[model samples]
Target: PFFLYLPHTAVHLPLVPGKNFKGSSKGGAYGDWVQEIDWSMGELFKAIKAEGIDEHTLVLFTSDNGSAREKQGSNLPLRGRKGRTDEGGMRVPCIVRWPGRVPAGSSSRALTCTMDLLPTVAAISGGKVSKTPLIDGKNIWPILSGKSKDHPREAFFYYQMDQLQAIRSGDWKLFVAMDSKKRNWGNPEGKKALALYNLAKDIHEDNNLAAENPGIVKQLLAHAENAREDLGDVGRPGKGQRKAGWVKKASPRLLSR
Candidate 1:
């Protein structure tokens, strides 16, 4: 009946744990912050049970991106880090909890992204998404509820700023030709131009199969082209992109006096 978006500033830069949680973790400041978040979740569940809405609530826990390489976090087994287009930069944990609705201890490997949250939440709440301006999200409740095995998303495109970086369709992920800077991490040469990986088999993205599988590369390229037409890429503006509202001489104001 209600929606609560609780975003925590912890586990980010300037890690500051509560006085009670300070020095509680052996991993130092980062671990202390993690423990603090764990405590926060416990408090939230306790409140939910007290309100008797625990059974009706559908909770989703996820992160915007993988751990920052500069931080004490690790994205082991996956190549590259937060700023790159590698699996490490794009992949993050997504946990859904709904009592009696979503089966406990059940998991799905269905590829999903942050964009899918809009439609999925809308579907779960019995809300309708507007037709105009378009939406790139898909309802994934069926996938989450274990009612469907099919992938709701056909493909997911990756972008670093306005540049289309990669495309993932099914198990295949293709990185098209593009120049990169040194900060992209793994790709020290600063040019990946063309690369392909079967994520199911090569989660580390070490083996490049782009030469062996030309057909797949071509298919993913076509998908990328289509995305560029709709969502845009470097040097090109997408037709589907909505013009952002701007204010002339905008001024900041305090939320409270």
Candidate 2:
């Protein structure tokens, strides 16, 4: 009957662990913060159980991006770190829990993004999303509920800030040519014009198959163009892009004397 979105600031910058959890973890401060987060989730679930909403509540646990390179976090097996467009930066784990709705102890290799959350939640709640601006997300309830095996998304475009960095369709991921300045620590040298990788075989993105699969490269490039037209790239405003919210007057809050 109600929707709750809880965004945690823990396990992030500053790495300030609570006094109780300060020395509880062996991985130092980072591990201590992680332990605190685990405890926070446990408290949340305990409250849900107390309210008798555990059966109907759908909880989604995910991160916005990979671990920070400066911190004692690792995105091992995947190529890049937080700011880059590599799998490490773009890829994140999503865990969904809905008692009988979602399968238990099961995993999905399907390609999905945070953008899909909007439509998926809309579908679950029998709500409607605006079509005027045209949302990019797709309903992935079937996929999550294990009712469908097909990937609802045809392609997912990767963007670094305003720049269109890469595109992934199925197992093939193509990193478009970018300036060295735009490159992050993971992609220090910047990517070639069409550096491709088959994620199915090379999850680390070590092998560049662009030279061998020219046809696939061309296909993905077309998808990139479509994304650019719809979502926009640097310097190019997309037709579908809506105006961002702005405030004409702003003032900082001050305590009353």
Candidate 3:
């Protein structure tokens, strides 16, 4: 009730629905799964109202990352799928409902990320941070209050621990793939490369504008330099922030190579 994270683990793997909600939707397996998640959320919402704290409570609903829409998961109009720099993977679903606090059925496309949550909650609770650094976020109070409609930070970096690096500046997003001589970003294509998408125009990311727009690439790279520093070489081992279990003792050919 105090801190509720209603994440859908079933959405990630196996795609299995429990017996209680096995075939409950007109949309098939995925639809049924979505309905399950929705039903659970309804419970949370009802509980808050039952406690008569709906007005004071702030409910933030969002996915961790974009859906791997390419995995037959359904990206639809959004280009690309999960696990890539496509909008589907990064452009998550989010909604904030606060009775009397937030305007009803409103939307804000101010470009946000997960890291911004801590500082916001801290500010909301009047928290004190003596030693712990703010780390990749700040208190986005203005946005929540409907006073501001843009990100407070000058720049935001999305790091996939070396597989790729994405930096957001204003409306432009730059994605640079990390190639490890050990395993490279696009080696499945063997010399394949990272592609850039002007999410504004090519939300589906169908066109590879990297070669056609060298000037844009240059500009994006310059902006991306800041994010790349913290990004490790994906093809190279031991560089990722948190090593995956499979990467621990894997051979170069199996790990990065």
Could you say which candidate leads in TM-score? Answer: 1
CA displacement after TM-score superposition, residue 146 of candidate 2 (Å): 0.5
- Model 3, range 58-154, lDDT digits (tens) per residue? 8888876666544436766876556655576668776888877777877776767777788787788888444433256767767877878976866
Scored against the true structure, residue 251 in model 1 reaches a CA lDDT of 100
The C-alpha local distance difference test score for the whole of candidate 3 amounts to 0.67
State TM-scores per candidate. 0.93, 0.92, 0.77
Candidate 3 has its poorest 10 consecutive residues by lDDT at: 180-189
Off by over 4 Å in 2: 179-191, 254-257
TM-score of 3: 0.77
Whichever of 1 and 3 has more lDDT, that candidate is 1
